[model samples]
Target: MRLRDLAELVRAPAALSVPGDTVAGAAAGGGPGRSTPGLAAASVCLYWGGMAANDWADREVDARERPRRPIPSGRVRPSHALLTAAGLTAAGVGLAALAGGRRALAVAVPLAGAVWAYDVRAKNTAAGPATMAACRGLDVLLGASGGRMRQAVPAALTVAAHTYTVTVLSRREVEGATPALPLTTLAGTVAVAAAAARKGPGALLAAWYAAGYGLAQARAAADPSPERLRAAVGAGITDLPTLQAALAARAGFPAYATAVALAAPLGRRLARKVSPT
Candidate 1:
């Protein structure tokens, strides 16, 4: 398979949102350490793996509803996608272990399991959104491996809340949603932003996140069309770094928070080339 096909198979651009989970966790736990980058990389691997596994599990469905997807388009074989998912998951866990020892492994293992379970078992079930949210929450804890795990709980929950909203919106990407759906997610978005704001520069960043992402949700609520819902989902994915940045700032890392927020625009630009959704 070509490199581009592999990229598409994993929804590569979407991985931009993964590292910030670790960053927020690190900041909240005890500020970033040398192992933070490795942990972040591990999180990205798991995210990409989840995306690949999701496609593998949805191959049959995609053939009917999303034929242009890499697997359904025949640009990527299902077996290859499955193998890629397995390999990346292993790599993520291994990297976590290497970077933070057993402490990180404890979180990474379950996080990986949750990712696989969501893709293969829970994705079509009513538990899908919560399962996916748990995966992201575990990712934040993974970054707190060598730090105070308890201190990271708030940040983890914050990220999980945002993930829940995104996951809810994602379900309606193919089919149009009701106004109530976007309205619900919009409420979740508001709660998440409020939870992350705290006191500091983070408040401004949280507001920025709410404005950008909330606007998209509001637009979707107005239209309740499949296209609008998909756009809202994409915005949620790309705008996530802003929320992460807010969490980082709240944890007392304004400079690092600014650095993380920069990813938001870059994610948006890349999404234009490779859809984050």
Candidate 2:
């Protein structure tokens, strides 16, 4: 497969959102350490794996609803996508093990399982959003493997809440959503912003996230069109780094938080070339 096609298959630009989860976790767990980068890399691998697995699982449906997707468009084969998913997942687990030893493995193994389960079983069920949320929550915890796990819980929950809202919105990306759907997600976004905000730079980042992501949701609520819903979903994916930055700032890491927030604009620009949703 061509490199560009592989990038599309894995939603590579969206992987920019993955590292911050680990950074937020590390901050909340008592600040980042040497293992932070390894854990972050592992998170990105798992995210890419999950995206590939998602496309592999949805290949048939995508052929009908999204024929231009890499797999459905014949730019990527289903077997190649599945292999990519497996390889990336294995690499993620290996990286986690090498970095944090047993501590990281505790979260990584389950996170990997959750990713596969979401693609193979839970994605179409009522539990889809919650399952995906759990995966994201676990990813945050993975960074806390070498630190105090209890302190990271709130941050993990904050990220999970955001993931839940995004997943709910993503469901209607192809089919238009009801006004109530965007309204509900909008409320969730407000609550997430409140949860992440605190006295400092984090608060500003939280407001930024709420404003950018919330406006898209609001527009979708007003129109509830497929196009609007897709935009909202894209905004959710790209704006995630801001939320992570807010959480990191709340955890007392302004510099790291700023670094994390920088990914937001970069993700948006990259999304123009490779859709995050």
- Candidate 2, TM-score vs. the true structure? 0.99
lDDT of 2 by residue, 16-68 (tens): 99999999999999999999999999999999999999999999999999999
Off by over 4 Å in 2: none
lDDT of 1 by residue, 57-109 (tens): 99999999999999999999999999999999999999999999999999999
Q: Against the true structure, whose lDDT is highest?
A: 2
Query: Which ranges of candidate 1 are over 4 A from the true structure?
Result: none
Count backbone clashes in candidate 1.
Answer: 0
lDDT of each: 0.93, 0.96
What are the clash counts of all predictions, listed in order? 0, 0
Superposed by TM-score, candidate 2 places the C-alpha of residue 211 at a distance from the truth, in angstroms, of 0.6
